[model samples]
Target chain A: MSQDHSLNLKNSHEDPAKATMEGKNKFLGLWFFLGGETVLFASFFATYLSLRESTAGGPTSQELFGLELVFIMTVLLLTSSLTSVYAIYHMKNNNFKKMQLWFGITALLGIAFLACEIYEFAHYIIEYEFTFRSSAFGSAFYTLVGFHGGHVVFGLSWLISLMVRNAKRGLSLYNAPKYNTFAIYWHFIDVVWVFIFTVVYLMGMVS
Target chain B: MTDNTNINKINSYENTRRKEEMKHQVITFVLMIAFTLIAFLVVAAELSRTFVIPFILLLAVVQVGFQFYYFMHMKDKGHEIISSLIFGGIWIAAVTVLTFTTIIWW
Candidate 1:
């Protein structure tokens, strides 16, 4: 079924991702899902902002967040975002191998980012006694940042699955949209992170 | 056949345009990185809170705009409805954040 249009569109269209009816629908539908996700994250952010000061004698964001670690995490995620852009670039250029290679780089960077997050959370729990039940601030912080981490884990899984499933198929209209959709999702992750660093970490240090 | 030659011509032309688009995206990425550095530095420099907070927030907004327009391809054709959907979400997000922050001011 996938190859039905393979002959007609393998190298013909500028963006194979949107060349077909299904691909167009998938692209639009993914954006719609992301729009809803924006609201979902907004709610978490609001909760975090309102309750951030209710530390209940526990450690505060000022005490807990280190600029160095967050800075490193930001670079890793931002570089990964660019790498996914490269992957999509190659995808559009109809170079399957290069596309996979860039996505592989993207995945590696994502893993590194995840590793840094795990280290951060563990340091908090073991060193500072900042558990979710510590106070309102703890709960809000964990929910907002932890939810973002959960998204990273989910995105990694999604990328790996798509790569492995299509390892042998190369570029086809059927799967191009899937890869493009992943890129969109990955960029949204970076967008959320920009806000997190600004509102949570940087502002936490400011005041 | 003549059609074969025509297809090659169009593909090459499109490839050129895509390459130019890639160039712009790379430029966007560089500017975004610069913005991130400025944000961190301003906070690290221990500036006055009155100015620092809003300045950094504005930088964040600009960087996010680059990401949305360049990386997400919202600047490309056929994204009108997608643009509306995103702006709508942002509208709700702003309202919700305002309500929560004001409600719990203590």
Candidate 2:
């Protein structure tokens, strides 16, 4: 094989995402970033936990959170996570078109999840008068969940950019790592949501 | 001819292994959805607060475990450093949560 084994179809490895040094670095770097991201979210969760009951004079978590909506949002995001896995799966098989198609599905689910979130927030502010400034509970609730929403927004932008920028290029070692990195980050966002729905919504309903 | 045959064999073998891995991922996704349903059902059923809280949190933890280890392939080879970093983050997360829950309550 030539020096650029990654460019040689016959010499290419099964996973272009980790076939080169840059790809490996991108993989490791994303995980390292996620480790830090975990701590960042944990702090927000701690704050929310400490102040979740301080409603002062406004609506509380139980009254504000609807199980039906949260369940739908959870399914959307969780399915998006699976779709991303499908994208990565295709990437490994060198099936660029299928990878893009699955990633497109992942983005659609994310957008749907964000739409539900925006609707939830509007319902709170309109129906319950539960603005972020209303109480400690309100502030914590908005900050925690809003932060997650903000991540989804950012992730959507990231995914869209990656898709658009690489649309003409197809799959190559140069860009495979980038897509893989975004998939991992997307999965981590879902991991955060798992904790949020459990601790914030379900626990709030319990008590 | 020999080189072409060799590459073809490796590609087929890798494709089979990857297909097997994908089966596991789909299975994990199904299990995660089931866990989410159970958590929601238990909470919606209005069970004892103390029991339900811990139980749902346990389910969340298990689901996340499946996400990381199965879907993210953290259990795959060459992930030792990544594992250490993730577990370290978890340690910090635990301490942070504990501190806020215990020390800052009003």
Candidate 3:
């Protein structure tokens, strides 16, 4: 009976995030999911790169890309990644309040990124008349970057949902893993953005 | 009394481990910022495309490594599954890019 009591207390006191069998399985499964996501993005990248030069007499990358605005967008998203890191740090410490705070900052930053992207797309359409249907390059550009922007939107919604659903309950073994996996997803999104910034924006500006 | 002591010991160990992890994360974040600055500077300065392109890509590669190993916590124990899977994904990506670029050019 004493052994059973000790075992129960030990389980209760352990890290809630990885304490349960279900949580561990979810964690591992998500990593594999991300692996598949990597391949999906890779194929997109390949397609984009292949068709990048096929402008079909429309605005080319060099004609449309402005470095300053993209630079700001990059900074915002990168800082959001850092804020998410802080959130996870707090999560590890089991500091529910601080974790939520940092995650909130992360969500705000992501929103700012989306806002910048919207403005960027608007500027492209209004100033340059570069629509997705304008040329092959246009299609490739929108599909690649727009896909990433779609992910940012999804990530933001996921984050907000996690925050709202768990606000009253505080951190527990169940929701802790949920938060952790969401963080992993956020980091992957940022990682994809990193590539987009480099291959699409930076390289486009230079070439 | 023994149980209390054991619990305290475990707590202290976890605390130290967490501190070390935080330090690594902060350092990685700083390095990533520096990499970003270098990438921007290379382009803003209008260096030769040949040099600027490769240099910025190299920086990006390093930053990706840091993002995966540090921010994603792939360096921690029991993360071998994640690490292997990600690397496998990368392998496939590399092959796809190579195949497309080569075949299209030919």
Error of 2 at A72 (Å): 0.3
Q: Which stretches of candidate 2 lie over 4 Å from their true place?
A: A8-10
Candidate 1 — which residues are off by over 4 angstroms? A1-8
lDDT of 1 by residue, A38-115 (tens): 999999999999999999999998899888999999999999999999999999889999999999999999999999
Ranking by TM-score: 2, 1, 3
What digit string (tens of lDDT, one per residue) describes model 1 on residues B6-105? 8788988888998998899899989988998999999999999999999999999998899999999999999999999999999999999999999998
Q: Which tens-of-lDDT digit does each residue in B23-57 have in candidate 2?
A: 99999999999999999999889988878988999
- TM-score-best of 1 and 2: 2
For every model in order, the fraction of real contacts preserved is 0.62, 0.82, 0.62
CAPRI accuracy category, model 2? high
Collision pairs in model 3: none
| Model 1 local distance difference test score | 0.92
User: What is the per-residue lDDT of model 3 for residues A1-207, given as tens digits with 9 covering 90 to 100?
Assistant: 244443232334455567777778889989999999999899888888888889999999988998889889988988898899889878767788999999999999999999999999999999999999999889989999999999999999999999999999887766888998888888899898888989998888896
